[model samples]
Target: MNTLTDDIDAHALEAAWGELDRVARLRPIHDEDSYDHAVALMNRVLDVMGDNEQHPLAGLLELLATLVGNYEQKHYSLI
Candidate 1:
């Protein structure tokens, strides 16, 4: 079983970096257009992963959701 303190090997770290780079290439949501794109990406991720907390893409989905939420909160008035 894996624990939080377990160190990730170099190969795993490299793979993680690769994934981050690929995702970063998708440009984060900064304006209306990017916001729409981000929403689409988030929807795709959700469709694949659903609400499974143990899914590999869960962290990425959560990060995208947070980015979308932050952009919306800043650009639109909340009720």
Candidate 2:
């Protein structure tokens, strides 16, 4: 398990960041269309990443999912 005290692997960190940038552009969910796009992106990531907590992309997926949920809660009534 990785911890804060663990020594950072610079090359691996750089590759991870690159993957994150490629997968998630990290755009603001400002409108319905943008929110929809975010939802789709999140779904794609979830399909690949699943609920695996140890996966490197898990954090990015969670962040996108949270953004989607927040936008939906604020803009639309939940059924």
Candidate 3:
């Protein structure tokens, strides 16, 4: 099966660097839709985990996840 963490090469990762950068810099995802999009993107990274080949995209995903998680924690923290 195609995985995000499989067969990843520097060149392939470099190719995706721009998109990863954009995602990393994404902000103001205040609505559920935007949050959902981030989640979806994260899930997509997980689903493709084996094929990412150490793709920097994964790092972007992690950063985005952190951002989303931080927002959620502040806005929807449990009492």
Candidate 4:
């Protein structure tokens, strides 16, 4: 069992899902501050994903990315 606070060793997002699941939903990334947190964590994950070309985590990352993007788009529109 891996806790999110534990050092993330696996670079693949899918491989990280079980660990991510442990913490992902616990942190609410809805508002600017929360989203910033999410972005920072996600960017770290992305750094680990560098130049892999293929990773099991890609799909899950894509899903999370889209979710975050949509949330930002909907909530932060100046219009």
Better of 3 and 4 by TM-score: 3
**Prediction 1 TM-score vs. true:** 0.66
Residue 54, model 4: lDDT of 79
Sort all candidates by TM-score, best to worst: 1, 2, 3, 4
In candidate 2, what are the lDDT values of residues 1-79, reduced to their tens digit?
Answer: 8797588888899898788679666677999888978988888888887768788878778789889888888889667
lDDT of each: 0.83, 0.83, 0.74, 0.68
Alpha-carbon shift of residue 34 in model 1 (angstroms):
0.7
Regions of candidate 3 where Cα sits further than 4 Å from its true position: 1-26, 51-53
Q: What are the TM-scores, per candidate, against the unseen true structure?
A: 0.66, 0.64, 0.55, 0.55
Worst 10 residues of 2 by lDDT: 19-28
lDDT of each residue in 1-79, candidate 4, tens digit only: 7789576565675666667677665254668877776777667657778767477656656766776788788898888
Candidate 3 lDDT over residue span 1-79, tens digit each: 9887677887877867767567643555788887888787777777767676588677766777797898799789899
lDDT of 4 at 79: 86
Clashing pairs in 2: none
- For candidate 2, the TM-score is 0.64
Error of 4 at 21 (Å): 3.4
